[model samples]
Target: MSEQTFEATRAFIATASAEQVELIAAALRSRRLALRPAPADTTATSTSSLMKIARLGDSVQIARIQPQYLSGLTGTVINTRVTRVDIELDAKSTRKLARAKQTRFEVPAGATSFVIHGVHLNSLDIL
Candidate 1:
């Protein structure tokens, strides 16, 4: 490896915990998956061929995003479109949704609901 890259790797090794390193690995894998072009049928909710049927009022969990607290937060689906779902987070989970940390989308402080793409959702109580 180049000297700069070697040094960066060394620094990363020194500063990153096991879980942090795993998160980095998972990100790389997710990125790789994102680039592949082939996808399954469109009937199921999908952004990158992930097949998890979604419907309004289904309880779901968010995944694969920033502000880690939002990941795995359970919420109820308030609306559904071909590729998007609006979730009204459970009252208990609203505390974990930090408005200041939301970079890609604007959600107000103490907001209880947010829209997410279907690929990022995992059906908790799918029907």
Candidate 2:
């Protein structure tokens, strides 16, 4: 078995006491954490858009990169312009989506396959 990202996240969050969790939840309020749905074999809805957007709701299953796509995407997309669409795990809870950050890609209208990394994801929706 491998170290599940969500499990790791939950463990990390568990370090905080119940009071802290309540405080954190209170602070967050209704902010929906961002998430990346796992990629599927489905086809893209549109083929010629500047960016194909997607949204992943809460609780989905995902696997970390299997060492092949890790090199290209081992960090956050704080810099550089992304050119491919990707599913990511960016939730504010720091456990469900691992700090709830948004990951984006620059969808190229010319390719049929793309890979992204640093994706701690569970579910996703296509835009």
Candidate 3:
């Protein structure tokens, strides 16, 4: 994506309604897909092997875009998609701050899993 588009997306996400964000997250999660950058050779075989490497239950470090959220948070991969990843969040820190009533970006209550979109792939780093 172009820099302009990327920034626009970030802005949109930042102001997106809770319902809208949840809807997008739900759709992405349902796919159970993961994305890998295409190889240098366009005709090369797909990166099924690489995807498998970050399989379910694998530990991963996901970069955070919103300060209200945690950055470099370690979580277990619960699902993957060609353009997104689903992770079961580690709440060791969040649990303590759950009482905060600040109106900021946050994981939904009772939601253990969250989806990271392909556009934000750079924000995800597999450990």
Candidate 4:
């Protein structure tokens, strides 16, 4: 980290209120999932693996999603592109997300679908 940036961060923390500090801390906790670069050693996904998980109508579990609380929710694949999947979350899952994100985030009316990147989905377990 650069000295100027380091100093600025320190100065902000030095004067920030407890709530502000906590919010910053929470961001730090989720930074890895927000942007964790792959190492050079890792290889790209194979075609077969993609087929298994990227097929339309497959059931999938949400993982490493932003807002973090959305992780573990289950949904069904409604559409699939090259690297993104449009999922229609179950009614129960929609209700759970709505309640959890009501204050911190906007929950649009009749919002039950989400487009998730293939990489962010931890599992595409067939049901």
Measured by TM-score, the strongest candidate is: 4
Q: List per-prediction Cα lDDT, in the order shown.
A: 0.60, 0.34, 0.56, 0.60
lDDT of 4 at 94: 72
* Predicted candidate 3 versus true structure: per-residue lDDT over 53-103, tens digit per residue: 344566777665555354656667666544455666566534523445555
Model 2, span 6-60: residue lDDT tens: 6886787789865445434533432322233325774765432122222222222
Clashes of each: 0, 14, 6, 0
Tens digits of per-residue lDDT for model 4, 1-127: 9999999999999999755565455455455444656566869643212223345677777765665776777788776543356677787777677777446545566776544444333344445
Q: Which model, 2 or 3, shows the larger lDDT?
A: 3
Once fitted onto the true fold, the runs of candidate 3 whose alpha carbons sit more than 4 angstroms away are 1-53, 96-119
| TM-score, ranked from best to worst | 4, 1, 3, 2
lDDT of 1: 0.60
Candidate 2 least-lDDT 10 residues: 75-84
What's model 2's lDDT at 53?
22
Q: Per-prediction TM-score, please? A: 0.43, 0.18, 0.39, 0.45
Candidates by lDDT, descending order: 4, 1, 3, 2
